[model samples]
Target chain A: MAHIQLPEGLPGIRGAMAFRPATARPLNDLVEILLHAPNSLTPAERELIATYVSSENDCYYCQTIHGAVAAASLNGDEALVKQVKHDFHNAAISEKLKTLLVIAGKVQRGGKHVTTEDVTAALAQGATDIEIHDTVLIAAAFCMFNRYVDGLATIQPRDEAMYRERGKWIARDGYVNVSKEYLPAEVAR
Target chain B: MPHIKLPEGFAGISSGFVYRPETAKPMRELAHVLLHEPSTLTPAERELIATYVSTQNDCYFCQTSHASAAAAHLANDWGLVEQVKHNYERAPVSEKLKALLTIAGKVQQGGKHVTSEDVAKAREQGATDLEIHDTVLIAAAFCMFNRYVDGLATWQPEDPEMYAKMGQHLATEGYLAPSIKA
Candidate 1:
């Protein structure tokens, strides 16, 4: 049961979002900008960053949702997503992304945990300042998002198929479009 | 010297935003919406939520700045602000607010740490659904903001008065107004 009276059947953050649409608009807008917008980082890579942090935070809903989106963006490579989550250092990703993940990991633990050496390593590996900045923001934002979903104890689907289906929709339409379709009547107001 | 070379004189997160004005636009807009917009929760109460979370994160710049801002909103009652930061349970605030602070404190720690009982407690104390919702958002956003500032190791002022002064300006002018002009 959710901490509040969320609508039935919608999983995870979606339910909580429908319960209060007023706050949902900006939150969804931020996610759209961070994950779907045109940038140096590919949408897959950005979703991977969010997935990685969600994994570290042990947020099941976030990790699954973002992991599925990332996989969809990367040619339906769910195995790659799982591998990266299990251990990105050994995963078959570029030196640049791996180094960026290092910074993201440190941010997950605590912001102060990210060292000057970490930034230097990423820069040396061809990670631009903008990429680095986005990685930190993605990591930081997921921390908040994770807490929001789990804090409310919203219902979360465990079936992998649900994630894949949802991922396809989100990947096809992007966050804003899907969010608009799902906004509860009161929240739409 | 920050992780990135931020503009001089601007303290904490402000300096970091100046370093990358591009990201600052949406971030400032979010703060403006969350903190400055008219709402049932008084600006002071909202600032108190920000201050409490920052203190929990132990971000000196945020805790002090928002603490002063919160105090300014409450007629310069610095003592009251300090009390809320130190121990909201013992602080002289409404029973409803105290219950809400308990929820905010749990959010500062981690979201999953908050239980259904916590929500129930807040409801019992006369908090509306919207108040509870905003409190969670405030706490969650500050976690990101505090980490953003501390992650970069920005310059934080040690002077207590400086924070109080900034707080006064923010309280009087609101986050968007002063942030825009600054």
Candidate 2:
């Protein structure tokens, strides 16, 4: 039961997005350009940053859905996604990603928490300005997004398979101008 | 000084925007739509919500800049803007805005902090679904923007007059192509 009367059977943010498509347009556009746009960061790496931040916020729906997206882009390696979420510092990833995650982690805690040294460290790891910029924005945006989805108590399906299917679809096609049917009235049997 | 090499002479978030126009475009559009677009809520009231949340976050740049904008919309009522930021519960604003501010406060703490009781109170005070929705989004979005500004440690002008001029521009011109050229 969401605070607003969103369209039925549209889980999570989609229902809320449809409730006010005006705001949704810019939000979706930001995600498309920020995450899917051409850049040095791979889709999996970028999705990993979003997932890690959501996990830190304890947003179950965001973590699960974004984790599915990361894994879908990573040849269905769910275990790696789990590892990155739970213990990313020790996970098998590039030092550069680990450093970016550290910066992302600080942004999730609080903006002021990110120190000058953190930026310098990322630069040492060969991260470009846009890479660092997108990392911070992604973490910050997810903070807002996680709050929106949870604040309204949007419908979140407990079943894991649901995210897997949606994950593949989003990874295959970018986030811009997708069919509303992405959130089908009936979950496919 | 910002961690990134933003252009010189621009203060706070504007410099950051100039540095990264790609992200800035959508961000500016979101701010315009949320705060400046025609709505049931007055521009003053909407800017007040942004100011209040930034105040709670202790973001000097966001709070003062938006407070100036709120003041410009409120017939240059800087005193009222200060009251709303420090003690909105007792501020001279309508009951509707106070109710919305409470929800905004809870959002600054965390998303799940907003309880059903909070939403109910705003509705009870004549807030529509659109107002409530916009309130929540405004609060949530400011958190992102404040963090973006502060996270990078963007340079902020210490002079209050600088922000006053900036606010007049924002109140008059809206968020796109802002003239922080001072």
On TM-score, the candidate that comes out on top is 2
- Of candidate 2 chain B, the 10-residue stretch with the lowest lDDT total is B1-10
Report the lDDT tens digits of candidate 1 across residue range B1-182. Answer: 66665678888888867776656666666676677688888898889989999998888988998998898889889899989999888988888888888888898788888878889899998888778877887888888888888777778979877777788888877764343213
The C-alpha local distance difference test score for the whole of candidate 2 amounts to 0.86
Would you list the clashing residue pairs of candidate 2? Answer: none
TM-score of each: 0.92, 0.96
Highest DockQ, which number? 2
Docking class of 2: medium
Interface RMSD of each: 1.6, 1.0
lDDT of 2 by residue, B32-146 (tens): 9999989999999999999999988888999999999999999999889999999988899999999999988888887788888999999999998888888888998988888
Candidate 1 Cα misplacement greater than 4 A, ranges: A184-189, B159-162, B177-182
lDDT against the true structure, each candidate: 0.83, 0.86
Please tell me what DockQ candidate 1 reaches: 0.61
